[model samples]
Target chain A: GQQVMQIPQYQHVQEGEDFTTYCNSSTTLSNIQWYKQRPGGHPVFLIQLVKSGEVKKQKRLTFQFGEAKKNSSLHITATQTTDVGTYFCVSSHQAGTALIFGKGTTLSVSS
Target chain B: GAGVSQSPSNKVTEKGKDVELRCDPISGHTALYWYRQSLGQGLEFLIYFQGNSAPDKSGLPSDRFSAERTGGSVSTLTIQRTQQEDSAVYLCASSPPANEQYFGPGTRLTVT
Candidate 1:
């Protein structure tokens, strides 16, 4: 079975600080997707990376896929209070079945 | 267009009882998924439906859990003889092939 593991299960930061979360998969992945889940809310898709060694950005957020396609990272610069939530990385293998999600990194930004 | 919608936003049932959760996917979407989220936990995949093909139920925890999609539009997940551990928020999401997914508010189930 394939599994995705995320680092820093929980994080707490003051406003204006930076935050980063990493996701690693046991096997190579065809694609990786990131999502955010607010408190008491459903998970929302953020971005997806399909190519190896790919990078994408959204404002202050940056996402990267490893050259081997076995890991990924999401980094936020100058975090704001609104950034508080859980960040998850999901990956799908060759079979194109359901996405396997990582344990997720819970970010807490304090004002 | 409307996003995924789920029925019985909240359900409280006794142990050993049966419960059914419903999910209505967005129109024209070809893929629908069911997931479970425990308190403060990540999403757990349960089943996936693509078009009219058979569903992928590998993520189901036990034989008591089963799901079906009718006409590729609506889906229902049934749990029989539920136990305390079955309490969780069941989420439904729909997506077009090779596109981002949209999620529903989810149904919170509590087994007492």
Candidate 2:
């Protein structure tokens, strides 16, 4: 069974601070996707990376995939109160059969 | 152009009872998935269905859990003889052509 492990299970930061969460897998992944779940809300699709060593930016959020395609990271700079939620990194099997979700990093921002 | 939708936003049942949750994936989407999220936990994959392919139920925790997709549109997840540990938010998601995944609001099930 393949498992995606995320670091810093929980993160709390002051407004305007930075936050980052890392994800790793024991086996290589064909691609990886990121999702965000607001408090008491359903998970929403954020972004996806398919190429090796790919880097993408969406506003203040930055996503990177490892060259080996076994790890990924999400970094948020100058976080805002609206950034309070859990970020999850998910990967699918080589055949795209099942999706493996990471435990997620819950981020809390206080103004 | 609507997103996925789930029925019975919340449900309460007693132990040893049976419960069914429904999911309506976006129109024309061929890939549907079922996931469970316990309190303060991440999404746990339960099952998957592709266009006309046999479902993959490898993530099912026990024989008590079962799901079905009819006509390749709607899906229903049934849990028989539910236990208190079964209380959790059952989420449904669908991806078009098997790529990015979009999730539904989810059904919050509580077993007493």
Candidate 3:
């Protein structure tokens, strides 16, 4: 069985500060996906990375996949109160299989 | 519908009772998955179904838990003789082959 581990189980930052969360796995992964779950809401797909050493950016957020395919990270620049939520890293061996989810990093931003 | 839909957004049952949760995936999606999340916890994989293939039930926690996908469109998760430990939020997600998943609002089950 593969396990996805995430760091900083909880993060608190002031508005305009930066935040980052890391994800690692014991085994190699075919793809890594990031999701965000707001309080009292379902998890929503954010982005996915497939290639090694891949980096993708969305507005103020950046996602990176490590060269070994066993690690990934999400960094948010100048965080805002709206960025408060749980960010989860998920992975699956294949496209349509069950995904292994990390415990998630819950981010709290104070304005 | 436009997205995955789950029925009975919330459920409350007594210990030793049985409960069935329903998940209606997005139309035309070939894969459906079930996950459980306890309070302040991560998502726990429960089961997976891809098209008409046999479901992957390796994630089921115990014999009392089971699930079925009917006609490859809808799914039902049944928990027989539920215990207090069964209290958690059950989430359903659907995806087209090799695509990102769309999640439903989930069913919050509380066993008293």
Candidate 4:
């Protein structure tokens, strides 16, 4: 079975600070996707990375995929209160199968 | 006409009772998934449905858990003799041709 592990289970940062979360998989993945779940909300798809050594940016957030296709990271710059939530990374091997999700990193942005 | 939708946004049942959760995926989506999220925890995969083919049930935690998709549209997750540990938010998501999934509001189940 494949397993995805995330680092820094929890993080608390002041507004305008930066934050990052790392994810590693036990086996190589075809692609990795990032999701955000707000308090009492469902997980929302954020982005996905497929190619090795790939990088994508969305506004103040940046995502990277490892060259080995077994790791990924999400970094947010100048975090705001709206950024508070749990960030999860999911990977799937066989197409259309259930995605294995990491434990996720909880971010708390304080004013 | 939009994203995924779930029924019974919240449910509270006694121990040993059975409960059913429903999920309605977006129109024309070919893939649907069921996931559970415990309090302060990440999403836990439960099952996946792709078209009329057999569903991938490998993620189910126990025999008491089961799910079915009717006509490749809506899905229902049933828990038999539910225990207190069964309390969690059941989330449903659907994907188009691509891998990016869109999630529903989820059904919050509380077994006491």
| Per-prediction TM-score | 0.97, 0.97, 0.97, 0.96
Question: How far off is residue B28 in model 1, in Å?
Answer: 1.2
In candidate 3 the C-alpha lDDT for residue B79 amounts to: 97
Q: Quote the lDDT for A85 in model 3.
A: 93
CAPRI classification of candidate 4: medium
Name the better of 3 and 4 by lDDT: 3
Superposition error at B83 for model 4 (Å)? 0.8
Please write out the lDDT profile of model 4 over residues B1-112, one tens digit for every residue: 6789999999999999999999999999998989999999988888988887788898899999999999889999999999999999999999874488999999999999
- TM-score, cand. 1 vs. native: 0.97
**Roughly what TM-score does model 4 have, to 2 decimal places?**
0.96
> Cα deviation in Å at residue A13, candidate 2?
0.9
**Residue lDDT tens for model 2, B1-112:** 7999998999999999999999999998899999999989998989999999999899999999999999999999999999999999999999975478889999999999
- Which ranges in model 1 have alpha carbons more than 4 Å from their true place? none
lDDT of 3 by residue, B1-112 (tens): 4899998899999999999999999999999999999998988889989998889898899999999999999999999999999999999999887678899999999999
**All DockQ scores:** 0.67, 0.76, 0.78, 0.74
How far residue B77's Cα lies from its native spot in candidate 2, in Å, is 0.1
Best by DockQ: 3
Writing each residue's lDDT as its tens digit, candidate 1 over A1-111 gives 366999999999999999999999878988999999999898899999999999999999999999999999999999999999999998888645777778899999888
Worst 10 residues of 2 chain B by lDDT: B95-104
Interface RMSD of each: 1.7, 1.4, 1.5, 1.6
lDDT of 1 by residue, B1-112 (tens): 7888999999999999999999999999988999999999988989988887778788999999999998889999999999999999999999887567889999999999
- Writing each residue's lDDT as its tens digit, candidate 3 over A13-58 gives 9999999999998778889999999998989999999999999999
List of clashing residue pairs for candidate 2: none
lDDT of 4 at B21: 96
